[model samples]
Target chain A: MGGLTVNTKLLRQILVGFVRDEVYKVGVRKGVLGLSGGIDSALVAYIAAEALGPENVHAYCMPYRTSNPESEAHARLVAESLGIKFKVIEITPMIDAYFTLTPDADNMRRGNKMARERMTILYDHSAAVGGLVLGTSNKTELLLGYGTLHGDMASALNPIGDIYKSQVWALSEAMGVPSEVIEKKPSADLWAGQTDEQELGFTYREADELLYRMVDQRMSREELVAAGFDAAFIDNVARKVQGSHFKRRLPIIAKVSNRTIDRDFRYARDWGK
Target chain B: MDFTVALAQIKPKLGCLDDNMALAEAAIEKGIAAGADLVVFPELALTGYFLKDLVPEVALRLDSPQMEKLKKLSERISIAIGFVEVSADYRFFNSAVYLEAGEIRHVHRKVYLPTYGLFDEQRYMARGERFRAFDTRFGRIGMLICEDMWHLSAPYILAMDGAMTLICLSSSPGRGVTESEGLGSAAAWQKLTTTTAMFLNCRVFYCNRVGYEDGINFWGGSEAISPSGEMTDRGAILEEDFVLAKVDGGALRRERIFSPMMRDENLAITVKELKRIDREKDC
Candidate 1:
């Protein structure tokens, strides 16, 4: 309803149905996700809670010591409001333990480590709840490859992966997601003072509009430029989308067999059961 | 000549042929119970959509046991269902078959296999080359599978062949949204179906599948549109529904008299113009 205007209520029903059907296909009626207190994960929680029922939705607020306390508070607010299962898992200990061994690790490496650490915990806990780990990556981040793969990107199911961030914000508000979660500055909270816009170098508002043109509308570079996008802006967005292609796909299988995996012997993820 | 059609808007588990076959049998029983003369299922209703590399694995030859079972059921009431058709040459096609009176009536291979934007039909299935109209108890009927209806000429060719009703089977993914509508795909489909019905002066029974195949949700909303371009009956959105459309044949007859677009059609001139354009483009 923001960059891409849609009937948020209808979109919500569709996404809820997506979660409900996808989870049930695997013979589970439960969903698990990291609640980062950001809109993306909060929105997924709201959808999942509605789909599998709040009793079946398990939420973990995994925060590092340096991670914003406000994120944890907002995550609590969302879980309480939805009446879902909520737990606060401190990621600081594990992340700190890893950084202790590597001690001179850069902020980028540290951030990636925290993400992977959370992924390991989330997956391990997912087994406990017997629920699928729901992904929180929106289309904007997924296209730009902004999240760490096999980390925050590892999910058994992702309802928000197709909707853009601006759309996430809009949908979150429509779905009665706590304004405390929706109105906050978008962040991964991998490190202190980290906001998504600061790291991405562009606001989702600008990126979503540009992406709506470049990706969804399928506008060419010249057409995008003609439609009021600067060369620099287009180049940055396009490069990030192209560069992060690996994050969006399965690991490449080498073609050696007569019928190779992913190359010729491709079956849908929904193949059979 | 009023007739009842049960729009079998059922969610199929992808590539689960036996499961879907069972589901189909139950739906057929439901339709028969509802006193429906015909039961229509969405495209790829037998094996489900998004088969991809599993296309060959699930494809049913016309004489396969699966078709034999469906043909047997047709003895009670008519059935129109979508499946991957395996030809004798081993070529596979996204096909729909009409079974009536325990006989295989018509098999319509999808002409336009959409390969862009979440669809990969062309990568797996062979393209159908023709649009033909065949006789049924209901009268002359034309069947088009999904993308075939997107091409304006496909319906035109069938109309020219004297089909009174156009049965369009689709497994359309729910996508795009506007303030005015829930799904842009559904809105686009309405526009296409109604216009084709209006201009072609025929009824359109658009049967679309429901449920998720991967993340792409097929919005159900299976509907029956009159020749006057009105949605006489529509099913539920994003949910399975057994929508019963009481199609009054008088609507088509009355609409034909009023607009007469079909009556005024000149195929000779249209074909001549197309040939001229083709020859010029060839040169």
Candidate 2:
């Protein structure tokens, strides 16, 4: 189902170079990131270690008590494999402490709360190490809006944000990530049985091919259906893309003044002046 | 006369005019030290590409001190460069310039402002209007800034105007890593330049920038193509590289005499057909 193949060798070079240059440009040669042990985080950990030397890469594995133990093991595996700086901070106490006040929290709320807690820890660790927070969200989750805003989505830079999840496996393999980590079922590990596919209602392979055609190729809905995509699947995917539009952009600022912050007063994140 | 030209595949500091100028000065000095006749820089070489709202901030008037400083360097060896140009009317243009003997030889404002897909050039800057070749100490040559050369008419117009050398200054971004070959955008550019060189019977020296800006990356595969469509030299892809290639007048003359495509060009018929197409567009 995943026909989108990239030149792994060249892609690795470009991504590694991107991380190296971007991290150094922002006045730091170091990068800090939350390593979830999923393919996305494992892949980013590998790239960050390669870009800034392993010594400069600080990886945090913040897992809730409910998170599968394998998640922590694989996270440790990736960190040890890369020889990057590693830490494991159990997120249960902070998350449970907050939820103890608000006992009516559902699965979605707990998951989001844990994600944001990990984000705060990463930022705090970033300041501790004087490094930028590296983002781990891939294109699939980003486009689907499956990530928690200001939580897992927050980062100073993301080398893999543009890469699709379907492609992340291949990139992870190419970069020598442990096979077990790459081959595992895609999961957020928020709960005992939680997997991304169970929640998203579709595999990444299906979504990637569909999104490649629907977005990159700019195929119309009629054309997509005619090309053999199920109407319901197409509808579901398109809605998520549309629904998550705000997640991909800066917050909207009302134009009370002539030049708004992001509206008309736009400057690049790498602005030299 | 045969002469050496240095393709300075530079990486510009985004919106930092002084830092970029230092880069330009260093490259120019290296070119002179190498005994090259000319040094070519990429589009907006003094100010990095993707300067969305920072256009006016980095733009320089033709008579600005920065322009004068670069002009004075041309006394040793001719220079071809790209920058944001501000007109007396206060409109900014993506412009390429040729400098020789401490004087500005010619300035070509980029004609086609690409506003599609990943590019949004038309949003912030004014588009250039025409393609006109000009004379330098070397010979008659034309300048194309990135997309200007994408349209067939841009290079064709210059060749028909008696220019035998076409210099393209580019800040092309790297994309499409899935192509069977190398980068998809790079392959497209290579095909474009190789065919243009063969058809126009001219020397095509392309200098493209390297470096990353925000999330975008510029691929730097600067090249020199001979009239016979032979790739004489090419800079490293996706990295900073300074490569030198020779411009042999004898080679150009021989290729033109052998191919004779430029010799047999029927501009009158082309003009008539263009006029007819223009008239039909109004229908």
Candidate 3:
């Protein structure tokens, strides 16, 4: 991880092209995304606005009642800087109504519900605006399955899915994302005081190194331990990755024919185009 | 002796052999007009890089029609270009061919096929058995395709075989940026070519392509380094360019006389060391 670096300028150029080509190839010129005032979403919005002009890219700041005010302000700042269409969609009623029905629902269930509701609103807006939904989950989160399924994980196209969370910060700074958002502690804004690191039991930097060794280098558990990593930490990270394997791929469709969907019938995203 | 070389930094469309051949033909005409003795193109210029599944379909044989056209073009000016070589046994190789006066002068299959990071060359192409230099009209010339040049042994083998000019064809992507070096890939290449030329005391020419294919952008910072590690010419980044540089055999001789690095190098000892390692280890 010492020499791990990225050419932010080149990455920006490639991602801009990725967002543009990936969306326009599917017969759409407009893109819609949730701007959470976090590094990942901010980077996506910046790229989307650059790819599909600021006019074509739509940003929605769907904040819950308990969400930090600074988050909304920062999201608005991003929208203004990019000069894109912005909306403040209050998700209070939606989450509160669900809580009213299931008053004993835990924080994890409520958080998942909020994530799904935000994505639902995004899709509804995508339909109204005739744009595709752009995803903001980075590689680190996707690998650890930190995202809620069919929620924040849902996207018609993801330009930054392959870039790790650490790389996301690099690109964000290079792309001129607000410094305040860049330096803040990352959180899902799921509950009142839930920081992502505190919840995950490891820092993004630590997790990225472990994941890079395990996934990219294909290092064994013994190799990781020998490389000066904690054995228990390695075990925990490996178990999390193994358990979350299903979150990264398409739903398993039991094969009944020679060419079942999501198998042999699968084609590239830009197949026809 | 002096040899005039042309570095043709071009963007080749993936999986389109006929179009790429046409492009090469046009570049050959330009090189001839520029009075270049040898024109070098990027690795896999005839088929483009990152041919994951399209390698077999676009691969050509030694007697391919495209090779014939290139041979005909070489009657005017010598040409060195990269292509996928198909063997009789159905194995494909990432290879390069040097043509002069309508005949194949030398064929070099890339010895080191990079399999790490963004590269997956070993999956599609067979590895070359050895590295060697062959005779040319200007002087003895050596050819390496992309990753082959990265390994010191490849160039050393060629230099030992009396190669005066080393031509490396590459399709390197622009990646990693440090404040001091600018584009990390280009900077690393500058050091690699210059150091290899200085240590081996032979002129080195590196030609890389520019353009996007499936999200990866190949930065075209093609360059020519003199025997003394002096850069003769460098191409623009992310653009198509045809640059000319003179490789001076006299300068190489002077450098060799002054430094005599090749004379000091002990190939016999290095060979023994490698053999010992190989016998002791599975690798």
Which candidate achieves the best DockQ against the true structure? 1
User: Compared with the true structure, what per-residue lDDT tens digits does model 1 show for residues A11-76?
Assistant: 889899989999999888899899988888889999999999999999999888888889889999
lDDT assessment of candidate 1: 0.91
Candidate 3, residues B1-283: lDDT per residue as tens digits? Answer: 7778899998787778988898899998888888888899999999888787678888999998889889889999988899999999999999999999999998899989999888888977899998889998978889998788888889999998889889999999876543333577878888999999888998889999977665566789899998898888999877789998877768978998998888888889988998999999985
Docking class of 3: incorrect
Instruction: Give the better candidate number (2 or 3) by lDDT.
Output: 2
- Weakest lDDT window of 10 consecutive positions for candidate 1 chain B: B175-184
Error of 3 at A42 (Å): 1.0
TM-score (0 to 1) of chain B for each candidate = 0.98, 0.98, 0.95
Mark the 10 consecutive residues where model 3 chain B has the least summed lDDT. B174-183
lDDT, candidate 2, residue A102?
Answer: 89
True contacts kept of 1: 0.84
For residues B1-283, write the lDDT of model 2, one tens digit per residue: 8999999999999899999999999999999999999999999999998888999999999899999998999999899999999999999999998999999999999999999998999999998998999988778999999998899999999999989999999999999888355888899999999999998999999999988998788889999999898888999998999998877879998998899999899999999999999999999
Per-residue accuracy of model 1 over B1-283 as CA lDDT, tens digit each: 8899989999988988999999999999999999999999999998999888888889999999999999999999999999999999999999999999999999999989999878888988899988999999999999999899999999999999999899999899988765656688999999999999988999999999899988889999999999988998999999999989998979888998999988899999999999999999978
Model 3 lDDT per residue over A1-273, tens place: 643467677677768877776677567899999999888999999999999999999999999999988889989999998999999999999899879988999988988999999999999999999999999999899999999999999998888887888889899998889899899999898666779999999999999888878887789888999999999999898899889889888889989999887565633233223
- Ten-residue segment with the worst summed lDDT in candidate 3 chain A? A264-273
Following a full C-alpha superposition, what root-mean-square deviation does model 1 have from the true structure? Answer: 1.7
TM-score, candidate 1, is: 0.96
Q: After aligning candidate 1 to the native by TM-score, how far in Å is the CA of A170 from where it should be?
A: 0.8
**Quick one: ranking by lDDT, best first?**
2, 1, 3
